[model samples]
Target: MQSISELLKFLTGTVFAAMPRDMLRELVLPHGHVALLSRRRADMIISRVRMVAGLFAVLTPLWIVIDLLVFSWPVTGLLVAGRLVTTVAFGMLAVSFRKSIRMREAYKALAMMFGIPTLFFIYSHPLLSHFDMAGPAAAIAAGYAFLPFVMIAGLAVFPLTATESAVFAMPVLCAEALVALLQLDMLNWSSHLGAFWLLFLIATVAALAGMSQLSFMMSLVRQATHDGLTGCFSRTSGEELLDIQFHIASRSGAPLSVVFLDIDNFKKVNDTYGHDAGDRVLRTMTEKLRSNLRSGDVLLRWGGEEFVILLPNASGATATSAVTRLRDIGLGTRPDGDPVTASFGIAERIADGVTDWHQLVEIADQRMYEAKMAGKNRLVGCADPIQYEAVVNA
Candidate 1:
């Protein structure tokens, strides 16, 4: 009995080991995979729609030929039925595509609704009475369903935790199992095996092309909008964000604050400690500022050794306090024991005044210079224009 139990345990372990790595991965690790799958699924659906549109363009004419030459009357009637069914399916898919574009439905929901149902319709067609037609249809369905599973499995190549791999892989494994069952039940196993393989090959090629394009586009967007050094928004991008915030604040009559920060004696640091140390100090200071700021606040690397913070729905007092906190944090030491300090200029948009985004930036920049002139490590500029001038003069 002990030997039999041990044998059973070993058999179970071997069976699990024999299973596809993707199936195992989804079962083990899932959130990042799920998010990634969700995005990819949405993209796949859009691509599928385009492919289907092209297919329909070609098939519509071929469908006419099949109706005229092959089927005669009853088959022609069935052909009409199939065409109608396909038309309705394409229409529904079009609607789903529009919704996906608008982000109205999750990709999983769209796939379940449009993708799965379309597969069912394709499998159920009577016009696929011919071996050639039936083979291609089955292949297409298998490829469509199986490709998602394959892509989901590729997530294992990423550095996911065990639990995450399991969780993500489970849904994908289920999807693959469903496809396998679909292949067994829906396909004309004897005649169209070649078509099934062809479809799988096509699906793989198409998915690779689609994902490659998406990755390139995402990389371009990141490079254009984000800073190379600190991974925050670039100065221009930050200004665009400020324009958005300014519009929102103007519409709501809420105050928007701009904080300009310049590293105190940053040139001196580069001269004394070297440029590498200066870079380290800037990186450390930005990280500190990011940690201290509120979630709503936007931080940007606004030129060399300078950063800009945009605070929406913040009054002059609140802006001053926040900048003061950031100022204190920026003046702290780096990991290599290099001391760093920053001077900040805080300015809030005047209510019902001619306060454009550029003007606000100008005011903040002027005040930041004032803070630097006064001392190396202080927060300044909470006073009215008249008082600000008086203080500057004093």
Candidate 2:
């Protein structure tokens, strides 16, 4: 019973977490995936959509031919030619997706890809004067009824949300009704109602799939980029951010600085107390440091006891001041209310000689080492009096 309850709880949490909230915003207001979702997640989803749409684009025309030739399905020659043309266009949808597309454009392009095929397959569902094809007609109608499910299967595989799937579904459902009405020379109440219920069911399933995939993607990125213990940016994420900021600063002529901080006697804390206490200290210290930093400034857990700060548009003085503020705050007394201090090293980029961001970090790291050598709880910094003068002289 306990195991069953735990399993049920897990399932419930997953269902809620994976619900696609973005679909609500997107259906009402369309925007690029970058604007709509996290840029990394958007890119991943778009890649998957391109692959699925491409496969569909290639195989759809062939499927149409197979049905006509092997199954001897009744389709007008004119309709066949039109479907071929549509196939060429559909193939382009896949091709278009092969490259990077923003969130908004991808949604739009994929919806069209999902919908246009339904329009092409709209055959008049005429009441047969002869009963011989009744079995075939019923089979076709059932298959047509399942088209929304087919459309939504792509939604499950791709990063498409329920609303986007709905956009594709609306056209197909409408086409199904139009064809049905035209076939019987009257409105088929059963067919219309069936389409409505099926759409609702399809939407629910599609939304669940979309939300689940989104949650999975977000979790993956978070785990990849953040330190698990302190929830600070990992060393890798910090380096990537530094590289990006370096290019931006170089292009925009903005100053950039790095601060390297080492927790004093962190190993002593771990040995004296325990690993758990050390973890508490790290998490608490990171929280305090985060409170002192700006949004654009990133704090990375460089290693076990060292943290690095990347400051875009900041000078060496700014980096020093920031570290001073950290020192002033006392970095939050440890869990036992014992004082804990950290040593700091600072480095800044200059126009005089443009060095790689890594070199700039290494300079700060060396300065941090110098501080440790000089005394455990202190700051060592290297800053030019006229910071950008070297740039001017250069």
Candidate 3:
């Protein structure tokens, strides 16, 4: 009998282990998990408002029908009040979420504010006698029903620290234990209902876990690919992307162009106004580049006071024209209210077998120096072989 019991335990443990963590998270976490994941707090607010609206849309008619059928005007009134309160809560939460996002506050503030009220409704509603559940069994079931919401809100508000998750798990486990105790007493043990709630809880937990993982992964990817200061692609990642574009253009026999830009007298700006102003200047330049470039073109911070623009499917002439326009636009503005300008060198991969993107960049860079030496705020092109040769000589 001892051996048989041990074997049964082993089998149960194995089955649990085989279940997907994502599935368990979805079962255990709340529906509001989607709201927590929004890139902006406004997005979260909009999502929450939609949820509240949807809930009211369904519950309002149901309450009306029940009131007419049972002739219970009081119950209908309570339902209306609940719906109104929920709507107001939704609106408040939305506003708070927006504020939190803008302020870059601890993410949990919105979650906690939204969650505490929800928990109160779940725990206190039945005790008011307007709702159906009254006994310990009802309390146990209600607690179980509220578990996912609490867990999800916790996830949104709290850092995904292991200690925090363990802390949150304690209350959930306690709720499940209470439900189990009620079932053991044979007082309100509906096996079907218990199984359904358990399944739902498991699913929610699994989903929350999955989303957390995905969010973390996305954050890492963004950090790796983007410049920390300007939010443009880093030089290495940009070059790799340009390489891929070059390969595609070569195969299609289409033109691929590069424009190298260097801020004229950038060091003077840094020396005169301090690094903060220099940073502001870089950010301003980035904004201009992002705004002026075509959707297909990519702008990258190549290095200090330097940027690279990749224009695919653009001829040498077209690339020169674009760079000239960029030079005009960039030089037109003074970020620090001081005189500023940029020199540009434009180049195009005109033939096949030029697989090395670095060579094109080097050619552009050389021409850019030529423009700077000849006169600042000028555009040079690879089409001028003699000029390039002179640039190389210089």
Per-model lDDT: 0.58, 0.66, 0.58
Clashing residue pairs in candidate 2 are: 18-211, 32-104, 33-103, 33-104, 125-183
Error of 1 at 241 (Å): 4.6
User: Per-residue lDDT tens digits of candidate 1, residues 203-278?
Assistant: 3333333333333334455577789888778987777677767877888988888888888778887888798887
Tell me the RMSD of model 2 versus the true structure: 7.8
Better of 1 and 3 by TM-score: 1
Show where candidate 2 strays beyond 4 Å: 1-13, 17-40, 66-75, 93-149, 159-190, 241-257, 271-276, 292-297, 311-324, 334-338, 346-357, 370-394
Q: Mind giving the per-residue lDDT tens digits that candidate 3 earns over 246-350?
A: 877878989998888899889887798888888888887888878898977888889998989898899888887776566556543455575457778877898
TM-score of model 3 vs. true structure:
0.45
Query: Which RMSD values do the candidates have, in order?
Result: 10.1, 7.8, 18.2
Give residue 219's lDDT in candidate 3 (0 to 100). 54
**Estimated TM-score for each candidate:** 0.53, 0.66, 0.45
**Candidate number achieving the greatest TM-score relative to the actual structure:** 2
Q: What's model 1's lDDT at 37?
A: 39
User: Candidate 3: which stretches are off by over 4 Å?
Assistant: 1-213, 351-353, 384-394
Best by lDDT: 2
